[model samples]
Target: MKKIKITILFLALLQTFSAVAQSSKIKNLENQREQIKKEIIEINNLLSSNKKEKNLTFRDLEILAAKINIKERLIKINNDQINLLNADIKSNEIKSEELKLENENVRKDYASMIFNSYKSRLKESRIMFLLSSSTFLEAFKRSQYFSQFSDDRKKYSNKILKNLTSLDSINKILKDKIVNKEDLIKSNNAEKRDLSNERNNKNNALSSLKRKENAYKRQINQKQRQADLLDKEIDKLIKEAIRLSNENKKSSTFSLTPEAKALAESFTKNKGNLPWPVERGAIIQKFGLQPHPVVRTTKIKSNGIVIATTKDANVRSVFEGVVLSILKFKGSNLTVLIKHGNYISAYKNLSKVFVEKGDNIDALQIIGEAYTNINDNKTTLQFSIFNNTTPLDPYLWIAK
Candidate 1:
């Protein structure tokens, strides 16, 4: 019986630690869910702002798709939380039943102990037991037996109380977990309904876009031409900067000073942890060749990701660098190129420029405001990173 009690205690301790770990996991999931919820709200605001147009455009459809994606993620997190709660509830239920059975056995033992003590009292008192002893040795032994019997009665009483308290606590935890699970299930179901409606809206928009496929194709081609121009301009400027850095020698890269080299090393080491150019935004266009969101047949290649943000959101520098050049192109906003040794980060599509050429800039320093198109009511930041002249995906470098 003592071994059984010890085993139960060990199991209880293990369960306590396991509960703490499980609680941590649930907390992490809740944090992620909250962040995703905020993103959904941002996307909804973007959609609301674009509602000024009489009909939905490809941009509207893109925002809707993003919303649906985030909504699904939120629901998945909710399901995960619910699953954890279910496991906890099941474990608690098993423990409660075990406690109930143990308590029953203890109650039975206490009853038997009380009945035996009563019968002993009826036969002879403890004082009489000592007086009736035939010798001093026997009296001492009888006294010890009476003391042990009293201790045993107290131990049984305390055990019963402890078991009852533990059972009550477990029952309370089970009730709370069940209620939490039900709430999560209700939330998940509501999100699913919203997700279904968004999908329908996206499908309707896609159908409308298909009705004007040829026009969209032309627009895609025109956009590609503009991108090509921007790419060439960026490359030319980088080459020119390299030429100036290596004036006495012929090289295709910048001749880095010790300070510049250290900066570049730090920048390379901080990959995937770089800050965003815009404070609050979502990547609408990803890097590299992907089928156009609207016209799948028309492939669009991007050297960097395009972030859609609030109107006139300020664009910041991702790292410390010297502004290499301030450039502008026809039918496009201004571009600022900052050189971190041989690595170059470019922020384009600015309505207003803050820093000038040769100016030193720090990370998160505001450089310009993102241009907001009045026609579509969309504001986007075009961000790119390059190693010498080779284009690297901005999405890979920026924090998720």
Candidate 2:
């Protein structure tokens, strides 16, 4: 009876642990799904709206491709979640069977013990055994044995009660799990529907855009030239800033100042942990080479990053650095660049600039407010990182 009780207890603990693990996994998957849904909505809005001015140009196709790649990853995650649920359901079913078996064994043991106790009491068997002892020592020993037997019987009774309680709990859990499993199935079916719709939209959009291949190619070339020109101007400004910074360091060598050096080292060490330039925004465009989002056949390349945010959002520095340049480009908006050692970060599409060239700024310091498009009221900041003349993806450096 003791061994049976121990087994039941162990099974109960195992089932509890399993349930908690499954619950945690489900929660994590739900969070990931929400984030993916948000990104997909943003993409859909971009496609449907007349925000083309703030939209990804042919040169920004690489960013759009990365966004699509993220969607693919989300789909794979959903599949994995469904597989996990299936496995959990199977495991729970096996555990429920084991619990039922243990409960039956407990009931049988309890009934047998109660019957044996009743039979012994009716026959006066325990008292007779003690009375028939040949000596005082023998009688005492017999009494002790009987006392132990009664204690054992009581312990068995308690165990039976506990087993019943555990059985009730386990049964409830099983019922609840069935409901949860059904909900998971429904969620997966809904996700599949959304996935299908998104895929169909992507296909239709690609087909429609391909009809203007020549015009799309021309637009791509023009956008590429604009990006190249911006790249050149940014590179030149960064070099000049670096030269000036070095000169200042040389002039201040007598003071043995190490603050700038330490800050620079700190910035380098946190390569992939840098904060976003804007307080709250999403990456509407990514870095690297990829096919255009709208002009399907044409590939768009980007030298930097494009982050979309709420209207009138403030742009801030990811790290402490000196203000390199604040330029008004094409009479549109302001662009602020900051230099940290050999690396330079640019923040563009600002309506107002707070820091001037040569001004020192700290990490997360608001440098300027981003400009909002008059039509859709969507604010976007064009961010870029450069090591000398080579452009690097700001996304890789920023914290997710």
Each model's TM-score, in the order given? 0.75, 0.67
lDDT of 2: 0.71
lDDT of 2 at 93: 68
Clashing pairs in 1: none
Model 2 misplaced regions, further than 4 Å: 1-24, 40-75, 135-141, 170-174, 202-211, 221-281, 295-304, 310-313, 318-334, 338-345, 349-352, 358-365, 371-379, 384-400
Task: Kindly list the per-residue Cα lDDT of model 1 for residues 1-400, writing each as its tens digit.
Answer: 9999999999989989998999999898988788788778778888887887797777787678778778888999999999999998998999999999999999999999999999999999889989999999999999999899899999999999999999999999899989989999999999999999998988888887787768878877997899889889889999988888888578888899999999999999989889989999877777999987656677999999888899989999999999999999876789999998889999989999999999999999999999987767788888999999999999789875
Candidate 1: count of backbone clashes, pairs at least 3 residues apart or interchain: 0
Clashes of each: 0, 1
lDDT of each: 0.89, 0.71
What range of 10 consecutive residues in model 2 has the weakest lDDT sum?
A: 248-257
Angstrom error of the Cα, residue 246, model 1: value is 13
